[model samples]
Structures are given as C-alpha cells and as structure tokens.
Target: MSFINFEILATSIVILCRVVIISLERLFPYNAHQSLLRKGFWNDLGMYTLVQSFVLSQIIFGFAYWLDGITELSSYGLLSSWPIWGQVLLSLVVHDFYIYWFHRWQHHNRYLWRTHEAHHSTEDVDWLSGPRSHSLEILINQTVEFAPLILLGCAPETIAIKGMLDAVWGMYIHSNINIRSGVLQYVINGPEMHRWHHAIDHEAHNMNFGTKFAIWDWIFGTAFFPSGRKPVGYGLGDENFPENYFKQHAWAFRRFRKK
Candidate 1:
C-alpha cells in the first residue's frame, strides 16, 4: 500500500478508537473536571495537530526518501518477508522502547525540557492534550524514532500501523476520562497512570516517563504508583510562560538567556 493510503487508514482507525474511548468515559463515572477544552488547549491542539502534522510529515517523508538513496532502508521489503502479525508485534515493542528513552531524555535534559514543557503547560489533561507538543520537539522526536524503523527495513504499512496504535494510545492515556485497570496499572501506561505523570508535584512530574509500556519506568526506577492519592495540580510550577502558541515556540529558544 502507498503512504497516502496507509495514512488515511491509520488515521481513521485512531479516530474511531478515540470516539469509542470518549463514549465509554462518559458512561462510566470518574474525574471529568480536568478537560482540554479549557484555556490554551485548543490553541496548542490546532497548531500541533492541524498545522504541525502537515509540515512535519512532509519534512520527515522527504528526509526519509533522501536517506533511502544512501542506505538500504526501505519500508517495503521488511513487511514482505515476515508474517504480518509478527511484524506488528515487533514494531510495537521496539517503538515503545525507543519512545521510552526519548521521553525520559526530554524531561532530564534542560534543552529538550524547554521544548517539551509546552505539553505540560496545560493545567488540564484530556484526549486533545496529547497533541499539545512543541513543533521542534515533534520534529526531533519523530525523526529519531522513525530512523530506527526505517533502517530496520520495516514496511511502510507496518510503520503506519504502529504509528496509529501509538496515536490512539497517546490520546487515550492523556484524556480526562478516568478509567481504572486495578493491578494492570502497574504494567501498562493508562489514563490513571499517565495523569499522575503530568501532576505539578515534583515527584509526579518526574516519574512515569514511559509512553506505552510501564516496563521501562519500572526498569529505570522512574515509575511511581501511589495507592490512593491523585495529583493535587497539573503543569509547571514556577515557569512564567506565555499562553500564545507562537510565544511558546519562541520561549523554547529563550531558555539560553537563563544560563
């Protein structure tokens, strides 16, 4: 299948999943107070999802094609040789592992943290909150994450499938809809687990860095699971950042002035 076809199909699936998850959340009772519809949510979502995805997709595809000439990294050949199901399972594990460290680094490194801070700026958490990322951060993170898959020769279809899964997983976990998984929360990164990760408390803000799987956090000792407590607040504590999208982008660069 072509990249365009893959994108359409993948996007459709993700949208469908979001709808189901949203509906389910409405039916079940949980904390719905924290929603992305509040201040700064739509602004960040519009830029990151609508505007930035288009530009970044073009840049990433162009760069991937350019690098294809110098390397034998074609997404077509890898899928043909492996069983379709196996390819998907492998992609999920590998991609999640890659994202685990990528996310961790963004928090630990000052420069990356500057760009990543935009996502955490929102006091509210919801489905749309996942897309509230810095454009520069998205570009850098996606490029690095895609490189491994491309070099490994995974088919474009497999990559598309993995991408869609990640998108839905991200949106679900970031959503305001509260769903509990009991002990499963320790193994997987669900909404309950992820909400705490966005908490204003230093401990909550610093832990739960895994994107999909909780294994990485557990392995790295960054995983924190409280028995019966929820995060008191969300977003950065002392950062006097602007609410404007363009200004947020600019603020990422201005971090150097502090040094």
Candidate 2:
C-alpha cells in the first residue's frame, strides 16, 4: 500500500482502538469512580494529544530528513530488502527496548525527570493520561524513534504502522479498564502493570517501566506486580502541579529545589 493509504488505515485503526478502549473502560473499569471528563481532560486531549503531536511530528520528521540528507543513509536501503512485516517487527522490538531503558532512566535521573514529570502529573490515570507527556520528552523519544526508520531505509509505511502500534499500545496500557493478563502480563504489558507505574504508592515507585513489553521489567528485577491490591493513588505527589498546557510545559523548566 502507498504511504497515504497506510496513513489512512492507521488513522482508522487508532480511532477504532480509542472507541473500543473507552467502551471497555466503561464496562470494566479498574477505577470505577474516575469520570470520562476528569480534571485536565480538555487540556490533554485538545492541546497535548492533538496539537502538540501534530506540530512535533513535523519537527521530528524534518530533523530526521535533515540527518538522512547529511548521511545519505536511505540510499543504501539497509532495511528495505527485508519484508515489510519484518521491518515493522524489528522496529517495534528495537525501539521498545530503547524506550524501556530510557523510561527507567527518566524515573531515576533528576534532570531527565524534569522532562518526564508532566507525564506523571495526572491524578487520573486513563487512556488520555498516556499522551500527557512533556513536549521535550516526546521530541527526544520520537526523534530517536522515527529517525532510525528513515536512516535505515525502512519502508515508509512502516513508520505509520509503528506509530499506530505505539498509540494503541500506549492507550491500552494506560486505560482504566481492569485487565487480568495473568501469565500474559509476564510478557506483554497492560493496564495491570502500567497504571502502577503512575501510582503514587511507595512500593510501585520506579517500577514497571516497560512500554510495550513487560519482559524488560521482569528481566531487570524492577517488576512490582502485587496481587489482591490496587494503588492507593496516582500522579506525582505534588498537589501544586500546574493545570494549564503552557504552564505545564514551563513547569518542567523551573529550578529544582536544593537539598
């Protein structure tokens, strides 16, 4: 399929995934009391998810193209010889691995945490919560994400397919739907583990950092899956976190408190 056609298909899939996830959340919610119009919902949906994503996609793709121009890497078509499915699968595993480590680092490194805290500021951890990432964080991660595909000459449609997977998995892991993956949770990540990543609980702090796969956490001894209990709360412990979109972005730049 052409890139445009693939983009159309990806868009449809994303919309379908959002609808299905939202419906499931209503039917079997983990946090049954959390409302659809939770606090900061408009800001997250209107500004971060829609506006920031579109604007940054242009900038990230432009940067990747500039880098490719200087290196002329796409001309070699390094990954083009591989089947499209192979390229997509390879990109997913490689980038998922990269994000798993980077995500863990974000929770530990105070400096990087500045670009990451906004993602954890939401008191209500739902499907929309996943996209509430800081612009700098998204810029860095996505540049790392798509740049590889361009540099290695993966099929152009692979980027769209991968992006669809990212959006769907992101929403799935953050959705409020109660998921009992049991053994599957050992391999694939879902709300069961990821919601704890946003939890304010002491035990869950800095644990379950995998994005698409749970094997990283299990392998690295950071997996915190306590059965028969739920997180006491969500979000950063700070009650003073900003609510506006622009203020939230600027909040990441504020001077850190000294010890």
**The candidate that achieves the highest TM-score relative to the unseen native structure:** 2
For residues 46-139, what per-residue lDDT tens digits would candidate 2 score against the true structure? 9999999999999999999999999999999999899989999998888889999999889899989999999999999999998999999999
For model 2 the local lDDT of residue 57 reads 96
* Model 1 TM-score on a 0 to 1 scale: 0.88
Question: Top model by lDDT, which number?
Answer: 2
Flag regions of model 1 displaced more than 4 Å: 1-7, 75-80, 255-259
Local accuracy of candidate 1 as per-residue lDDT tens digits, 111-174: 8898799889878777777888888878887777666567666667777877787689888888
Q: lDDT for model 1, please.
A: 0.77
